[model samples]
Target: MQEFAKKPTAHRHPLPHGTLTLTTNASSMVMCAVLEQDTDDCCQLLAFFGKKLTSVEQKYSAFDRELLEVHRTIHHFHHMLEGRQFVMQRDHQPLVRSFAKTADAWSAQQQHHLSAIAEHSCTIKHLKVEPLPTSEEYRYLFTIINRSTRWPKAQPIWQQKAESCMKALIGWVSRHGVPYIITSSSWGVNFMSTLWNSLADNLGAKIIHTTAYSPEANGIIKRLHRSLKASLTARFQGGIWRKELPLVLLGLKTSPHTALNISPAEALYGQSLTLPADTFQHTMSPASPSDNRKAFERIMPAKATYHIARKVYIPNELQNAEYAFIWVDAHRIPPHSPDYLGS
Candidate 1:
């Protein structure tokens, strides 16, 4: 019981002889799970999660909901169970046979979620007993945690900010689509405004504000800004920093972020931008047809692997096409109006 209560630490080394155990339960509009690894009759709890179902999800039957709990728990611990087979213990007996059979009668949403979980190698075991004490404790903790937390009441991220900031955020959303959340300072310019109400009414974004004067709250962004300023001062010296800021920002955006394993631009756009260094490689003489063929053969397998990993699909026609025209949005074109470019 003490071991089950202790939070699991990441395994420094893979367990050569152990079985990953997952137990899940669902009731009404809530679900929870208890993850453990068993070796030599000893079981160690790995992690647990509890979540309230969405309105659409609440419509699902008890059986489907139980399967959803299984799917969600497997997804949460995928890293530990990726290549290895694991045992899934569910309180619901019907799911054991249901999942074994074809998913012809499953709802599209359930099917979609189940398909992702199915890719993981695992066997489902139906528990003959009632819900475990750990699972029940998790549910109690989840409910209490959900109630005690100050959940943001508004539907949108920009729900409570000044008109200027609201307009800036709206413009950002218009261009980039809705962000997962908007972080801002708890200042008069952000907190006291009617535009925030409008934002909540229009676009629902999760807005989080930092404590005033708390540098530690947004330390990463602050540190990066300081670094950028230092770099600009060193590179530009006595020149106007504003004049060179865009180029510096572009360089920073294209450069890899140590924590993310990708550039800021790539994180936002899902692809890396073509910088000057990319063009530098193309300046050399073109390869002969035979050399190109050899290069293609060498790179084809890796390219195929990359596409599969990224879940990117290219049509046969597009892949074989000699020329491809990527349509750019009119608003993104320089000088918005064609005549403004002095044409």
Candidate 2:
């Protein structure tokens, strides 16, 4: 009798619900923005666009190329916004202004695209750009995680010149909604710190910081990086990595998420997504039974059961582990068999 009850519960675990996290890296920022919304929820991506030139001479030579890339990113964002709503978060503020400047600078065809985005009648909010800490040890990737979806996305913009990266971030947030919280590693430049102060004075959004070195507090973003790298490695062969970024990104967006037990597309759109024919082909017959359709529709698994199982399994799995910790809100816990404050 007990086994039968457990069986039913176990089979229904892993449904996609609750908070969503959006994680992004620089190479795949466009794809990240495309996946930032669901039926009733909002998904956001914070991105850093890299600048190619290292010196003033190179900047002049690469001017056209840099402008084109920036235009492309803006165009992509416009394309993703079709009939959807989203919030953008960023570590810098200038990118937002650049898009507006670029829009003003466009030729006819490009102007048309920019005009349409302007006509979309969307709202763009700019978070005040923050300065990084003076300490060199604390800089790492920046991330934006949605409070509701528990989806986190990150971009490593450290090597890129800070100003351009900040601009991209600002542009992204201006288009998307304001974020509830921004998480980052301690040290490096405290980019969000300045922004938070301004936001508190202006927008009234609270800026909270997590404990130092306790990235698990920012687990959603960390997990996204791990998953993205793993997915990229699995799908691409040696040369494919550099050549087929678009396809790899499409796969990431469409792939099933373990936490949500559904593809990111489904979580945001409230419907099954159609994959490109080149990437996926339908195997079912045209006259396949309705039962099969129902099976496909059931993307979300039972949440309560999954949470119970996760709680029971995670602690034992972490036993005797060194340097492991758990983060809840502002607090961090060292590895141990201990109950969470609220849970």
Candidate 3:
């Protein structure tokens, strides 16, 4: 830290040529921000900010709270960001649409926040990432989600029984807010547990248990498990699989789901995520065009093995086209049920 600050050409003052990317994430109780400069290989950290929310502040709706975090974090480094027209990355979605909307739609409090941030940032490129805590210690990943938006999250728990399930459920509900209903498999520990009953009684959430071994009963999470497994398989080739879970979740949230045209991040908060492709200045060194496409294909949510489908490799010429054609086999895809993969 001392050496970087001592360097005359370092980011003590904002640089003229590089782009700044400010990424922020808000938990139930606090918010954090990181400012970085875009380098060839990765982002270089410039500054970081963190704050605990007040009692009243913590009660703000998720979207509003995330926006407040952004507004304050930008002002904290206003001098550096002013006139820079940098990028923004948040964990929630509403901040994107809120900024795009006219002031007329915002409440007085939101207006106040915007006024404070107006000077520091005008142009913004938004991205989102939901926090995914691993089950390294617990050895189990209990998944939960906002079913309406398909905004899924996971937590590591020690076991699949009543007490462990209760803690994992609480962890997600506390951070993401409560769900009106929870659908799960008819596992003996979960369905028969008195602890589970007590939890449902207190949270006022209705529990719907599916028939034994019928995954279709809770298809949403089943699909998520598939996507998670697919992403995990790609990263397992090398690197810590535990740490990669967060990025895997980010890919699922940011990538457009087959059921919904929009990504889960967008569906929940009207926000978009900046994908790796968005910031990659150049392709991987010594990799061919086909190899690069195949590599990126690994990040895609659906795997070719999951279904009998054709994978299309889009040409560079059509990268930015309004739309490109996808061929679907008539025998496999039913009428009005067309399906195809893209890379």
Candidate 4:
């Protein structure tokens, strides 16, 4: 087979002049891209990138794979191609639809891949590499949301290292007040790191670990994470998630909750946010603001009164009793037996 060059390698840095072009390809297993610039005589090489698809990625359709390949390439060369207009050369024609302004339904992953490199000024063209792909494809996500206000903050980290996590957490604390408690799952090395624990300790914050494989322990954060991702995926057409994050957060913070019947921002700050898209005037009423602190204090006496009247599990002596009765579910009980069983 004839080769482009036996030992020729692309320059690691930016080219001074000529048109910059990114050519990409992807198979089931692996994907590759070459960045080249049109010089006076020949197209001089700038850089190259390639990666093996993960098992999850390998299962994706051809269009998805090609789309992923394109996203990775733009992200890999984001620093060089960020501000300037450039050309993207790919084989799969299907991938171009993402760049087009259309109302067609896109997969969550597809929306995400497009959002990453959406900020860059680039144009996509057909190039036969065997096949094609979007943006700042973030590898790690650091998300924070207030338990009381339900206000959220999500940061995209390039690496899953502890330092990045620490930085993200510290930045959040600096902007918002230091949290009294920090809770997270055990999946991330960033969260499980010694540095993370130390940071929490130093900040006088208690670290709470969720039950392994159970999302319910931290369901609020998980739900917010899902919604945040969905909002970013749906509304954003281009640009890195970093830019989109604040916009999404704004909508989340200001949007009224169905249960509370008030916006989190209004609940916390006692006012509605002034936004570009807000058309109607919102009048705040002092009696109806869903401030949790005030509402809890106002309702505490009623809660105590109701519980006292019912006398349900009131001031139980279970701790002191040597042989206390335990409440068993119907499935755990005998074929025909009392609902409560001896422990």
- Each prediction's TM-score against the native? 0.34, 0.36, 0.41, 0.44
lDDT string, candidate 4, 46-113, tens digits: 88799999989987988899988988888888878877888988778778755885765888888888
Alpha-carbon shift of residue 206 in model 1 (angstroms)? 54
Select the stronger candidate by TM-score from 1 and 4.
4
Which runs of model 1 end up more than 4 angstroms from their true locations? 1-16, 130-343
Pairing residues by index, what is the TM-score of model 4? 0.44
**lDDT value, residue 266 of candidate 3:** 71
RMSD of 4: 19.3
Every candidate's lDDT: 0.60, 0.46, 0.72, 0.74
For candidate 1, write residues 171-258 as lDDT tens digits: 5566556655655545545443556745854687666676554555544445465556566665564444445555676777677665
Tell me, by lDDT, which candidate is best.
4
Worst 10 residues of 3 by lDDT: 300-309
Q: What's the distance in Å from true for residue 80, model 1?
A: 1.1
- What lDDT tens digits, residue by residue, belong to model 3 across residues 1-343? 7787687744434568778988888865899998888867766778889999998998798877887898888889888887777888764656776766765977788889877876565555556433333335545677876666678887666666788888888888777777788877666667667789889989999988875544556667777877887888776644356777888899888988765566888766655677776687654367688975764443333322232233548688886887666665334634556566443
Candidate that would win on TM-score: 4
